[model samples]
Target chain A: MRISPTDVAQVMTLLHDDPEFRFLILSDLCGVDTGSVMQVVYHLWSDATPDWLRVIVDGLPREDPRAPSVTFLWNGAEWAEREAYDMFGIIFEGNRDLRRIYMPPDYQSFPLRKDFLLADDAARSPGQGVRHMEQTFQPAEYRRTPVLRQGLGSDAGHMAPGIQTAELASGEDPAR
Target chain B: MTTEQTVRSLDDPDLFVETPGTIYDAIPPLPPRTEREAEFYTMRDGEMLINLGPQHPSTHGVLRVVLKIDGERVVDLDPVLGYLHRGVEKICENGDWHHAISNCDPLEYIAAMFSEAMPVMVAEKLLDLGVPRRAEYIRVLAWELNRISSHALFVGWLALDLGGLTPILYGFIERDEIVEMLAALTGQRLLFNYLRIGGVNGDLNHDFLSRLGDWMGNALKRIEDQQKLLNSNEIFVARTRGLGVIDRDLARRTLLSGPVLRATGIPYDVRRAHPYSVYPELEFTIPTREEGDSYARYLLHLDEIKQSIHIIDQVLHRMPDGPVMAKVPRLMRVPPGRAYVSIESPRGQYSAYGMSDGSDQPFRLRIHDPSFFNLQAVGLLMPGNLVADTMAIMASVDPIMGGVDK
Candidate 1:
């Protein structure tokens, strides 16, 4: 139940190996300040066994906010880690692909940080602007990453190594 | 009409290229475009971007997918939330105990009644205020009606998504009745604003009970009529039957609750698991279906409607009357502690978390929204289905954009 910080990859492996933990729903991840230092947290659940388990793994912040990505194990964990990255700035290593989610592609800073602020709410450029409800816009200011014309021609994102693109879609199983 | 299609000015392709957002002004009354496509083409690497909501209408709120799509099939789907975040957590952080419900209830519009009551019940536990017996019975009555109404709309929307149009109107017709019944007492229909700090804001009258009893007796037949309309229609069955299934194993693994979980054959109803109000006193079965398919989920809603009506009938029969509110200090305070109270809402298990610094206002409040858990199941069920089935799967989840994004 308790996974050591360095063996985080093993944590995901063990979860997959154990049939009981069939689906580990990565509920919410946050960085809780434990007074002197900070700890990156993970909340994983198994409905098969009906248990909500908290798998806490963290280290010094100067190093990348790295941890095992459960995207390979549970389909539900795909976005949760991305959210942790966007807000708490956690770097989930071995996650074959990673990208800015929620904020504009060129967002300057993660908004959920303890010391994060909001940028102006105005659509400055097409694709650069984060349109909420297609109403008031937030201009992606001079952020670290450059903004791209979003939703242009992109279809889908990452897939596990062995999974075929077409196979990993709905209606592939006619019986289903 | 013509052999090809109806005439309209808005459907012109040239309008999209030459005059975006100006389609409303064109005089020729083009056929309304059934689908709007806006792809943010031309991108570079290094940045991670995805679409959350545009794929499923369920995420019309702040939820967007931070997609790194290799093709139509998602290689990576990162749900970007807080875009619709109004900081309900922060607001609850700043407000007093009684003031929090004003903000919390609206977050989950589909299950607002349950959302409003769960917070107050958790606060009551912390405050050690025993609600009067009359208030207890009334709470049960109100919640039962609300649950039935919420389920009815779910029935209609699910049918609509699967291409059965008649049930939508039938379901809406039933929903309007409950809204009217709830409205007569609380004044407003949707956001009841019924729960006060110690007890409910108002108590039910005889007229509401009489109408409720009559409706409960006849509602089953009305619901069955809805079923006959589409339960076995070939296309409806084909579109929904085995698709978007979250197997029993996957459902429990994700900690999925409510009808969605029940559809997979687990009887984890919060009312049964952790009883509050007068639910423990009532006798009713937690309707569950063994198959995890969309058909199972669809059938489960009908079973739930029957269960809710049965519960409402019992509440009316046994509801004892007295003063609704229990006595409490005008300036409320509680010993410093934490209490988590969960209830079976229309969607699923909804709970409120409290950290009391022994003050009138909770130092911290975290709500475990049911839709948040249910919607996440989309990623699990969505794959392997064509783009068309996406909406059907999403509509089956019966999410509130406000609830999911919040």
Candidate 2:
């Protein structure tokens, strides 16, 4: 679901407090870059059932990406949040030890971003300064972006305008 | 001297100051406040920093756990990972959906079946592909076989870590038998890329089934012989019994699962709780021990192996005969959606979270490895124990650095 970055910590706290929706384990917390914006995805799972709830906070400004951290709620989120920050350069507010995980401490750019160029691939060949693959080597249809779907809303799992919630089944404690 | 003259004088050889020895020897030792440290000078301010391994055998893989110790107890601990990081998630994002199955084979190298199955199941979920009944049965059969072998290796390694050599050799015997069976079924021994997106790579044959049946019949006796070798040994019990007792709350807080969590009295098993594949039809118990110690965790491995054998027996009897692979396209494109599919791996609840942007390749592929999370509990388990007990606690956790670093 798409939510404001400001409300992420509060919403996570609310979900954690709810007896009906026991999202006890923070299964995974990761971030993605969608051209114009950065989106942070949080996957929560209840131990009792097969249900998993996904919470997405999208449309964070690309220039200064920041989201509230949930380490205080789930201690396991400590490393996961650091990893998210490491990959996407999205700062997790209030993370005491928010350090780079996979990448080196002095890494200049987030490697996962669409615009970031790999060092090896970015270097020009001996004689060919800047050569682009011609039409003869056009990539497959699936490799190219499909006629741009109705923006990030449709791209991030049919998530409605804001705070959308869906489940595999009903009566299994739907999130508020 | 003037400020400019003073700065320039620092470069003059006459004014230069030199320590008597190398850089490390130049620093003087800190003053000791207690009798424990009064006898000798310590490396840091009252604490010693020890790097356990990036190359030590007991660590099981390339995992470097820095331990800060005061006397014989651990004062602080920090695990340094990424020694084996191959950017697997990023690699999966760039590759086609079908090829990514092979890419994930090394994440949990000890039990490659579970790691390989995760991406396949997630892609299957995203595409809404229904695996054949026979294929599901085959998957469970292979998965159980892999689980038994992985646990066998763990039991042997635990004994080896606690300074006993014979149990590990016996462990190799059991593990070799299971691996030989799996290798015959799936063309590879360690990283079997046998499981594909739609279904498994191939079907079980008569030769494989007969051999597996014979092995399954005597598997319990072999496992028991291994348990008897180490379970009652006075030294083994003394070292591991109450060495690292992680309670239920700490296990939950640390996000521990599988045997470690089961050892703490939680009867949570992803296969039983979530009921993935053909696990719903099969009946087996999720073994739990109230002790929440290394000994309990060790016993849990033995108990769980027996349960896996029971599951294999059920699969063998109710084996269906049909097409193994579903009709998947040459190049598969998953619809724009997000799905998280988890299986009860030998270590814990190993999950694959795939986000597809209606492309042949995934936009992002995040793997929630159980060993990666379970390894975190070492900090809680290692604080009060003696220095020697560190090996026992780490062995009990059974962390595979391939999974942890990935």
Candidate 3:
């Protein structure tokens, strides 16, 4: 069932404390960036229900998504909340140790956000008229070309200008 | 200058003075990041900190715990993780639906079948696809075999960590036989990218069935031999029994699953709880122990191996015949929806949560690794125990760093 971020603590408490709907086990807690909004999804298990009860805290602002911590109900939620915070930058407000779990403490960006492009993603989907690496590659022609020799010569010149060109064993100069 | 003058120059007070800082000082001081870290780092009178592994063998993988010890007893511990973090979830979300299966394989390397099965099952849920009965049987067969191999390693490693060398050799022998059987079936040894979205990648062949037939004949005897080697060994019993005891309440509070939870007298197996695949048809018992100690957990692993073998036998007997692959499109686009599927992995409930936005690629993929949950119990269990018992407790918990860090 979908609930507001504010009702997370209240609903979870009722479900946990109420004997009628005893969702004792917090199976999973994850953060999702849905391009437009942020969501904190909680999967709870109980003897009362055969299926896992999924509680989605929907429509938290993407800029600074905040969800009430469920650590009070289950201690295992602490690490899961930390992981969510680390990957998506969604703050679990009541969690005492809400530091980064998987990333370094000084890590700047939340990697799971839609805007956070991976290092290679930029080269794969370059903007405007720029050709992507996959688009430019023709394996058959690439193999036929002496690209490695040309690249090595240019790299050597760029790296050390003082190096003299040496003659090959076949009496051919690389400078030619 | 003379030798005496040179020696005097070298020993000059001004020259001998340490510089305020150097190029090496570029690395900033990493003070405690969280409340737990700050508390653990602050040494009290007679309390010292012990940093154990990002590199220790007993840690299972790259997990480092900062143990605060007051003499021999552990005061508190702060487990520092993320050394093996590969950002698998983000990578899965970026790839196509099919790519997600292969990507999930490395999340729990030891039980790659379950890891691969998670995404496939979740995707199947999203698409409302049905797997063939034969495929379901095959999946269960593969899963049980994988479970046996994983539990074998766990049993051996736990003993090895406690300084017994023989059990691990027996463990590897059992593991190798099963792994080779899998390799024959899947065409890969470690990371078998065998599970597809609607069904399994390949069907059972002659080579795989012949190997399975041969192994099943002596599997029980071999398992018994391995168990007899360490089951009543005095040192093994003394080290493991009554060590790192987790009560029923603590196990529930921490959301512990698999053998760890089973060892706590809670007979909560995912196969029985939420019947999936061919488990509903297959007859196998969920074993439980009342003790909730390290020894109980170890015994539970052996019990589970037998149960898996029993399930495998039933699967082989009732094997159905049909096409393995379903009619999934090359570029499969799932309708906008969210699906979650959790299966009983060797260690615990390995779950995958997927969100699709009417695209080939998933919007988000969340993997709930049970090892991550089970590993947390170590912090609570280790506080009052001796420093040497740390390895024993951790080994019993059996947190694969690959899953923990992921």
Candidate with the greatest lDDT versus the true structure: 3
lDDT of 1 by residue, A8-75 (tens): 77776776567867434544444432223335555554556444465667453623556666655554
Per-residue lDDT of B239-279 in model 3, one digit per residue for the tens? 99999999999999888999999999998889998888888
Task: List residue ranges in candidate 3 displaced over 4 A.
Answer: A128-176, B1-31
Cα DockQ of the candidate 1 complex = 0.12
lDDT of 2 by residue, A141-168 (tens): 2122221122222233322123222321
True contacts kept of 1: 0.10
Model 1: per-residue Cα lDDT over B265-309, one tens digit each? 888787876678788899999989887888888888888888887
Cα lDDT listed for each candidate: 0.64, 0.77, 0.83
Number of clashes found in candidate 3: 0
For candidate 3, write residues A10-36 as lDDT tens digits.
999999989999888888899999899
Candidate 1 ranges with C-alpha deviation above 4 Å:
A1-176, B1-83
Which sequence of candidate numbers ranks them by TM-score, best first?
Answer: 3, 2, 1
In terms of docking quality, model 2 is incorrect
